[model samples]
Target: MPTDVDLGHHGDRDVAPGLVDLAVNVRAGAPPSWLLARLTGALGRLAAYPDQSSARAAVAARHGRPAGSVLLTAGAAEGFVLLARTLRPRRAVVVHPQFTEPEAALRAAGHEVERVVLAPPFRVGPGLVPEDADLVVVGNPTNPTSVLHPASTLSALCRPGRVVVVDEAFMDAVPGEAESLAGRSDLPGLVVVRSLTKTWGLAGLRVGYLLADPALVARLQQAQPLWPLSAPALVAVEACSAPSAVEESATWARGIVAHREHLAEALAGVPGVDVVPDARGPFLLLRTPVDVRSALRDVGFAVRRGDTFPGLGPEWARVAVRDPDTSDAFVRALRGALGQPAPAGDGGRPVGSVALVGGGPGDPALLTVRGLQLLAAADVVVADRLGPTTVLDGLAPGVKVVDASKTPGGRTVPQEETNARLVSLAREGKRVVRLKGGDPYVFARGWEELAACRAAGVPVEVVPGVTSALGAPAAADVPVTHRELAQEFVVVSGHVPPGDPRSTVDWDALARLNGTLVLLMAVDRLPAISAALVAGGRGGDTPVAVVQQGTLEGQRVLRTTLAAAGDDCARAGVRPPAVVVVGAVAGLVAG
Candidate 1:
């Protein structure tokens, strides 16, 4: 009963205003003129209660079932809740990563639901479900996974005491409705739930029906309210189940086959993207090295987040099929988000590109998603010593790793040489990643590389990371600013001694302020800096804390007063890349 997945999350939540929606599986340009006309004509009959006689008979005739076997509801969702409330199965099993409402409804009704999560390729068969499960819920052409289970496989799940509930919500989207069991009345304890929401685009109308044996249908109908379907909803359901509407839906379903293939093929061609094979639904299930949902949103598209499903994680996303033009644009945006170069006009080959990525304080996990994507697609990585160096070990074979680390008082790569290399590699048609430590703009000289790439006419992107200046102090449990102690915090570089001619900082002004002062690259000149601040009308007893190698292994923290900071750090052998915090908040954490 305790699970990490949020069963109530649905695809419509992913859509936002002004975004191209590829999250919901509803067919585009739906509720054709004919169906809309019928619903509009029925609106005048709102004075009368909804009569399910004609709609129920139409659905029964459509599936070759008797009227007693049909139970029309508000929607397929209502049908799921009705069943969850009515069934008293001792062992209930839900096959996922499919639609989540069944599990959610069962749990809401105080039923203990067990999940039979199918693995990748996401195929469903007989032995996958528990033999003792008296109630089984599955989706044909499942949501998120988009893998349609064979009719034979699902039929094999039926037993004398078991209730096999098959959700065929999107089955009408399948050409010829192949693998559909809607008309199979001979199977024992079989319940087929169908919806016109996706293909007919009547989701707002809330029209659907369920077919089962007469006894089971009567039991579920008792759980429903009086005249459950609305007058307009009943009209929509009756119109959608007609023979003419069925033929029209088949034509639309055939078009989806082509559109889905086009989108899947284009996405599969993208590096690091794995498409779930044999996707028979109107959407696709995709897995990538990094979560690209946010990246895709940046380019004006909304996709379903797959983590809400039982067996999927953040790396998975579900994208609906659209027209060829929309699919092409989506693919281009996806390629850009994944750090792959845009296709050139000639032969679709990738063009040269450069990305300035912030690797975040020495911790690979702290790297941004955009940065990780660029690293995965890079042909050349120009890395700094303080960056997440360990992550480079996971790069694919044949990826050229260039050492551009700046060592204090040792051999170093010149800034000019590094800039030149970035432009040169990009000119050679290589995807170049200029990886830096911490926030690239936070004393990392990343603007220089951006300028060089721009001057050389190379397409470039900048991905910001967590800066060590703030991360280090927080890692040591020291807040740079405390509401009662210090209301403001200033971050400054201490590469130059306080009194040096090259120093741009005004030590006197800093000492006059009643706030926290965070110093970076100041370990070597701590004695002079501390003395200068003390001489400038500042208390020698001001609290000071030093954090070294923040957010990584081998991190060290030292707490002292301003007067004793230099002596304490010297005795403790504190080194470069440490952040120094001065003010009352520095002593908030125990020494």
Candidate 2:
């Protein structure tokens, strides 16, 4: 797992080998010690096509189900593809913030995909669907933001002709296996897909399975080619069916849940963050004032961005929880970036327009080229203490620097007044820097300011900066895009629930992705974030880290898994100027 350009590992370069991949959920080592013993016995016959009936029966016995209920797949992603292809429901309503492959497949098959939204804090709305859609699909312990809905809620969505396909690729990490719908038999039109890639580190082998009614399974099976599963993959199935293997997996599940809680608590202690509360899954949601993605990258870490989901945008990201050491290392790298200096202040022009600029965390060095140009053109600097103070130095000696920074303990001006000031300045012909940290597009309240400026007939332009979610993780030397780890990245906020109009982050769609997540402004929400991830079905022990003052001096890192996230942040004393990363990239710190 050492840095290798040949494999396109995170942080790898053509000139220099880089990264011992952690973002990839697969294990660094080959077959586990116990599993190795099974290779000789069950895998010796690689000369011929695998016996499909026996291999499937092995899987059925382990789940205590009939063979008719199971259908082997070439990884769970294909199950969704198959279901999407085979099920010709009148309408396809997919839960937002879940995996997109299903929807994509449905679209390719000429079905209309309707989205159910889960915005911030990743909670579902009061009425999910019209109850009229015939084919519906979702994932438990949803991806990206890691918000897991309860099984009862998922069961309620199941009805005749309404194929509720649940992706449980991560369900093995949950200890109370009883909560999963896959083990149940009564629900009709219920199809469940699971992957051995994440649970047993067999992604390359490409082995997965589906469980549903015999009729549904038969229809799906007919669409796939014969010998859909490779010989080695079938061997893996036979090996995983052992009782001992299941018990060992159980132990790992318990550990993940415990670690997720611990990690969440550690993040909560950090200031200026809103960690999603009640995170029961392995990964938690995070919210910060800065652009989390750029912040992590600038500090030497890489994380997934949450912008692609139906309801989610570019302000969020996802990380994997690995072991303890890498998690801690990630935090230290972030603290350095957060404390990086901002551009210095200069004189004002008093011209008649405004440019709302994002600072991209506190680091002036990490600012986008356009942001720098806008900073130099600013006639007035209206900024808060949270933005890097050094950015003021970028201005001319006598630029009008309006200290909008609020008192730590005294009465502060209302946010409404601040908006009014920007509008007034622009109307008076002054080029203003409505300088907020991170990208103005992400959680900078730019939407409101733009609305206000337009409504007032004041000319306005927005200059975007690197979001801190990416910047902070970069400073920590983590790479979100290891070709082997994942195909997509998601960015999101960690503050309020996705369904809440007041929230800036997309909670629902993030809960459904097969990508990575990066969070911002999530210090206090660590506990809730942790619980949401666990409940969403991300492993409780997924690696997570909080970086305080990334890309600058005084960088402090708190490393832990999702279960222990809360406590670890507390122990490390991480404060407001931190970016939280939850994914396999966090584990790269040690590499």
Which candidate's lDDT is highest?
1
lDDT of 1 by residue, 115-216 (tens): 998998899877788899999999998987888999999999998999999999999989989999999999999999988888888878888889999999
Show the lowest summed lDDT stretch of 10 residues, model 2. 5-14
TM value for model 1: 0.59
**lDDT of each residue in 1-591, candidate 2, tens digit only:** 112111111211111112223234443346676665555455557678777887799889987789998999998878878887777788778777766677777776787777787667776643777768887777777765566678888888877767788888777777866458878789978888888777676766788999988877888889988989876777778678777778877887787777667656555555555666665445555665565656555433454445555566555444555544344334434444456322222123343777778877677777777777877887788887655668897697767887666543566666668778987887578788877777777766777666555434456778777777777777777655667765677766666743333465544455555566777767667777777776777777777878888777777677788888877787777667678777766666552
Candidate 2, 432: how far from true, in Å? 50
Q: What are the models' TM-scores?
A: 0.59, 0.54
Candidate 2, residue 165: how far the Cα is off, in Å:
0.7
